[model samples]
Target: MKTFTVEEVAQHNKADDIWIIVDGKVFDVTKFLSEHPGGKKVLVKMAGKDATKKFKQFHNDAIMQRVGLPMQIGVIGAEKKEEAPKPVAAAAAAAAAPLTPGKLVSADEARFGDGFPYGDPNWYQDWNSPYYNESHMRLRKVIREFAEKELMPYCHEWSEAKAIPREVVKKVAQAGFLNAASGAGTNPSVASLLPYPLPAGIKHEEFDIFHEFICVDELARCGSGGLLWALQGGLSIALPPVMNFAPEPIKKKVVPECLAGEKFIALAITEPSAGSDVAGLKTSAEDKGDHFLLNGEKKWITQGAYADYYVVAARTGGAGMGGVSLLLVERAWEGVEARYMDVMGMWGSGTSYITFDDVKVPKTHLIGKLNEGFKYIMHNFNHERLGIVMQANRLARVCIEEAFTYSMKRKTFGVRLIDHPVIRNKLGHMIRQCEATHAWLENIMYQIKTLPEASQPARLGGPVALLKAQSTQTFEFCAREAAQIFGGLAYTRGGQGEKVERLYREVRAYAIPGGSEEIMLDLGIRQATKNFEKRSKI
Candidate 1:
C-alpha cells in the first residue's frame, strides 16, 4: 500500500471525498456513512480527521477487524517511526531472555495444564494429586484437543442453529466419548456398543467416574451450556437408569442403539406444575394389563425433540412417593407429542415440552419394580448432582480464564486492566471460589469411588447436593464478575466476550436444573442430618 502524508491527505475534507485515520491506517468510510449502525451524521462529523479515539470508544477490535480493515487506503507516514535505540546492557539482557509471546510448551515438557493459574484442577498442572494418573492426563489431552479443534470453534454457530447437528453427535459417539459419558465403557455388555476404541491410550475397563468427570469438565471448556447438553446431557442422565434397573431385553435393545448414536433418550421427570417436588408430579399412568396407558405432559425435557425414547415418571398408585413408577416411553408410540421449548438458555439441547396421550408403554419397559420408582429417582439424583457440580465448576473456571485473558490484553487508564487493584480483587474472589469448589468436587468423587454402589445414595447424596449448589453459585458470581471485567464486550454476542455473554445467559439453566439452589441447600442439610443420625448411637 502507498503511504500518505498528513498534508497530502488534508485536501479531501468534504463529505463527497472524506478520509479518516484510525490506528495509523487511513480509511475511506464515505460510502459506509449510510450503512454504519450509528447514523451518517456521526461519521460525517469525524470525516477527514484522525478518528482513532472516537472509533475505539464506540467499537471493539472485532468491528474494526471486520469493517475498518476493508476500507483501509494507506498507512499515515507520521506513524511509521523507526524502533528507538536500546542501551547496550539492556540489549544483552533482552537477547538472553525468552522470546516475546513465548514458545509453545508441549504437554510432555511440563504438563503445565494450559499455564493459567486455577484454569484447571490444581492436579492438572503437576500439583500433587491422588486421583489423576497418566491415563487421566491422556484422556484430558484427548478431550481438550477434540473440544478446541472441533466443538469450540463452531459452538456459537451451533447454538444459533438451535440444535446440535446429528453428524457432530455421531462423531462424538464414534470417538467412544459417549460410551464413557453414559457409564457404558465400564459395562462390558454396553461397552461393545461403542463404534470405536477408546481414544488411543484410554482403556474401557479402567474408565471410572473420575474419567467421566474429566470428560464433562473438558467438554464444558467449550463454554456453551447449550452445546455440551445438546451432545450428552440427556444421555448421561436418561441412559443410566436403563442400564441399572431396566429388564435385560429392554436394556439390550435400547442401550446399544442410544450408545451407538443411532438413537437418543431423555429423562422426563420435571413437569410444568412440579419441579424439585417429585412426589407432587401429577402425570398419570393407568394399568391396562399388558401395557400401561401413559397420559401426561413433561416440560423442560432436554433433548426431548430428538429423543427416540423417554424414561418418564408417572403416578401409578394412590398418592405421594409410593404411587410413582418409571416407564420407558418410546417416541414412536401413538399419541406421543414433543415440541421444542424456547428456554432462557441451552437452546441447542432441544429442550422440549412433551405430551403423552393414552400412550401404551409395555409392562416390560418398567424400570425396576412397579411403584418403586421413587427409590430409583433418589439413586439417580446423586449422579445427576455430581454431573451438575462438574459442569458448573468448569464453567466457573471458564469465566476466570476469559476475564483473566481479557484483563491481560485490554488496557484502561494507560495500563492493562489486570494492573487495577479492584479488577484483581474481583479475580481473587472468583479464583478462590473456583479452587475451593474444585477441591470439594474432587473429594466427593473420591468418596463416590470408594463407597459401594448400593450405599452411595445414602452416604454421598447430601455432600454432592451441597457441592452442586456451591458450584452453581460460584458460576453465577464468576459470570457476573467476568461481565464487569469485559464491560460492553461481554454484553454483546459473537465477539471477544462471546463465551462470557453466552455463559452469563446460561447461569440460571445450571442453577435451576438438576436441582434448584434453594432446594439443594435444604435437601443437603436434611439428608446429611438423617445420615448422621443413622450412623450415630446418640
Candidate 2:
C-alpha cells in the first residue's frame, strides 16, 4: 500500500480531485461524490481534512467494511503513540486471582450479541433481568453461534430457493432444536417423544418458555423471516395441539417422527373464505362410522407443500365456533393434494394451497373431543402469537442495527448521517418501541409461567394479542426507518441493505399472519373487558 504525508494528502483536497483522511487512512472519494446518499456537498466540506472523530461519531464499523475500505488509496504516516504499561504489581495480582463460576474480573469481560446498543434485548448484555439467568445466557450464546455459523450465511440463498434443504431440517433436529421448539423440552409428554436428549448441557427439566423464546429470537436474527418460518413456523403452531390433546397412540407415532425431522407436519386451518374467523372454516369432516371423510381446501398453509401430517381444523358439528374439530389428516391419503403458493415474503416457508377431497381420516386421528376443537384452536393462538412477537421484535432490532451501522459511514450534507438530529430521532423511536415491546413480552412470559395452566388461556389471551400487535407495528416502523436511511441500497436485495429490504417485505407477513393488527387490538380489548367483568363479579 502507498503511504502519504499529511501535507501531501492536503494538496489533493479539491472538488475535481478530493482526498480525505478517516482513521489515518486516505480515501480518493472524488468518483464516489456523485453517488453519495447525502449528496456531493458533504464531501466538499471535509476535503483534505481528517474526519476520524466526525466519522466514528456517526457511523459504525460496518460502513468501513462495506464501502469505506474499498475507497482507501493510502495510509498517512505519522509517529504512532505507545500506551503506558499497566503497573507490574497490579497485573501480577490480577493474574493470581482464581477463576470462579459466574464471577467476572471486570464489567467489560462479558459481552453478548453484536455489541450495538439495543441491537439485542437489554438483558443480553449484562443488564440485571429477572427473567433470565446464566442458563438463558448460555442458550443465547450457543444459539447465536449456531445461527452465525450454520444458518445466517445461507439464509438469503434459501429464501431465494423458496425451500429449506431437507438435510438442514434434519440437522436442526439432530441438534435437539427441533425437540426444544416442539415443546418437548418443556412438556413431559412432548419430551417423551424426543428420541434424543436436549442440546448438550441443556436439561429438559430446566427448559422453560423463555428458553423457547430465546431459540426463536436467535433464529430471527438471521434476518430472513422466510428461513425462520421454513425451519419452525409450522412445527411451532401445528405440533402443540397434538402434544397437548392427541390420543396416546397418535402422539407416539406422529410426535417422534416430526421431532426427529423424519416427517413434517403443518396446521391447516385457513381457507380461501376463512382466515382469522376460524369458526367459519368450510373444510368439512363428515363422520362415516370408522373414518371421517375430509373435504375442503386450505390456503396459505405454512410448510403444507411438503408436510407428512396435518393438524387440520374442520367442521364436524353444526356451524360457527361450536362445530369445529381438530383432526390429524395424513398427506398421503387419497385425494390429498398440495401445491406451492407464490407470496410476497417468507418464500422459503413453502406456503401452500391444499385440497382435500374425500380423504379418509381414521377415528383415532381425532384430537381432543368432537365439537371441542375450537377451544383447542383458541388455546394454541397464545403460543403462536408469542412466537410471532419474538420474531417481530428481533426483526425490528435487525432493521435498527443495520441502519445504525449504515448511518455512521454514510455522510450527509457536511457530517455523517448519525450526526443529523432527524436520523437520531428515528433511531430513538425505534429503540423505544423495541425495548417497550420486549419488556411486555417478557412480562407475559413470566405470567404464563406463574399463572395456573387453566387460568392462562382466559387471563393472558387479551394481553398477548395486544403485545403481538405492538411488536408487529414496532417491526414495521423500524423497517421503514431503516429503508429511509439506506435509501436505494435498501430497495434491492443482497449487499449492505439486504436485511432491511427483506424485512420490509416481511412486515405484512408478521402483521397479518398471527391475526391482523386491527383484529388483534379489537379482540384484545373485548377479551380483557370480558375477563375483567367476570373477575369483578367473583
Residues 1-538 of candidate 2 have per-residue lDDT tens digits of 7889989888887899999999889999999999876689988888988978766644445456556888999888954557895453343233222223344444443445667878887655555566765566667666776777678777766777788998898888888877766666788767667877776457888889988888888888889999888888878899999989999999899888988888989999999999988889999999999999999999999999999999999999998999999999988889999999988999888899999999999999999999999999988899999989999999999998888888877887889999999999999999999999989999999998889989898889989999999999999999999999999988877666878988999999999987889999999999988988898985
Model 1 over residues 211-293: C-alpha lDDT tens digits? Answer: 88888898899899998788888888898888889998998898878877889999999999999899999999999999999
Question: How high a TM-score does candidate 2 get?
Answer: 0.82
- Candidate 1 whole-model C-alpha lDDT, 0 to 1: 0.83
Candidate 2: Cα lDDT at 452 = 92
User: Model 1: which residue pairs collide?
Assistant: none
lDDT of each: 0.83, 0.85
- lDDT against true structure, model 2: 0.85
> Candidate 1: which stretches are off by over 4 Å?
1-108
